[model samples]
Target: MVDNRYTILVSNEQFRFTRDQLESDPGNYFATYFFGEFAEASQGAKELVVEKDVHLFRLIQAHLRGYDIFPLPDAAIPPYMTKEVAIKNLHRDAQFYCLGKLEEKIKELELMSPNGRTGVRRDSPSAKRYKFGDETWSGLEWMFQDLNNDGYQLMLGKLKNLDMAIPSEQPLIPGFSLTFCWAKEHRYYVLLASDD
Candidate 1:
């Protein structure tokens, strides 16, 4: 059984769709395109492309721009596959992509200003906005309390968002991974994993 001890604070289906598209298509494309372009080029050409590589950057920009009209080249293209290159590219993409979501999360956290207040009118637009309703807050509160007890600085960290904003295969922190998602339908959903 999957470990359910960790909670899902929020789940953004669009975010998930974006991640899936990246992993399923663009991610593979860039991995192959770059490696192939490198391998097929002469040593001098390889250095030139390395110094001025545009394919991977373009693909990343395409995804970042959130445009889907431009069809990704079919995978029928032979696998110019290089595991090391693919892995490295995947890591870079993962970090950059997660950081973008991290920014969004930061914005949400910023919305939660003066977090320690209680019954502070509860009329402000931000208070009207609760992440995943109360359940999400419960789980987050648990984690925050635990982390605080363990000496993690609460002042240094806020519930910007959850790991559910990122892909299941990618982890921002070591050991434990958790994702939080919030969408129009489901106010909040979370997925957590502990390689325990």
Candidate 2:
């Protein structure tokens, strides 16, 4: 059976389209994804906007704690948490829990974890070219710009394919990782690639 636990984490705002709408027009199945920060919105903390699979609502709630405008899936805590808190936590969890390794994908397109952080495989050469965030982006970029520009949300699959393969034994810097997401299969899937 589908895990009902996933349903509890999502807010009503996420349900942009009805089940019938998805059946008639799959492309219209889009929703506003709110990536919250750990502090006040005016501070460095800000929500990363993106279009993602509806299933991610549960995964997001799984990591959340305390009160929030959006209640946590398993949390009994009240809605005291701000968007900032949610954003910070999500960033932390996404870096760890989201994607598979780069070397694995090169071997086969199937999703698989690598030996190192995210998708960086151990013992791989340091010659691979990589980018910290969006390789196609530059300047003071907003975290959620892609979400607004593109009608669809970013999915984990895109991250898996973005070649975020970094060298092994290196710590993933805060605010940066060789990860990406893709919007497909009605969900998001992150992948490990390096920008080294």
Question: Candidate 2: lDDT over CA atoms?
Answer: 0.30
Show where candidate 1 strays beyond 4 Å.
1-51, 68-84, 90-185, 193-195
User: Candidate 2: which stretches are off by over 4 Å?
Assistant: 1-17, 21-122, 126-129, 132-196
The prediction achieving the highest lDDT against the true structure is 1
Worst ten in a row by lDDT for model 2: 145-154
> Could you report the Cα RMSD, in angstroms, for every candidate shown?
19.8, 18.3
- Model 1 worst lDDT run, 10 consecutive residues: 6-15
- Model 1 lDDT per residue over 1-196, tens place: 8321211111211111232333334434323332335453223221112221234344443454454312235431224635334324534654554534423333333333334233434455433222222223323322221121111123223443432353233223344445343323333333333333
- The lDDT per prediction is 0.33, 0.30
Highest TM-score against the true fold, candidate:
1
Model 2 agreement with the true structure over 12-83: per-residue lDDT tens digits:
333332233222211211111111233332353212334433334443332232113232243532245454
lDDT of 1: 0.33
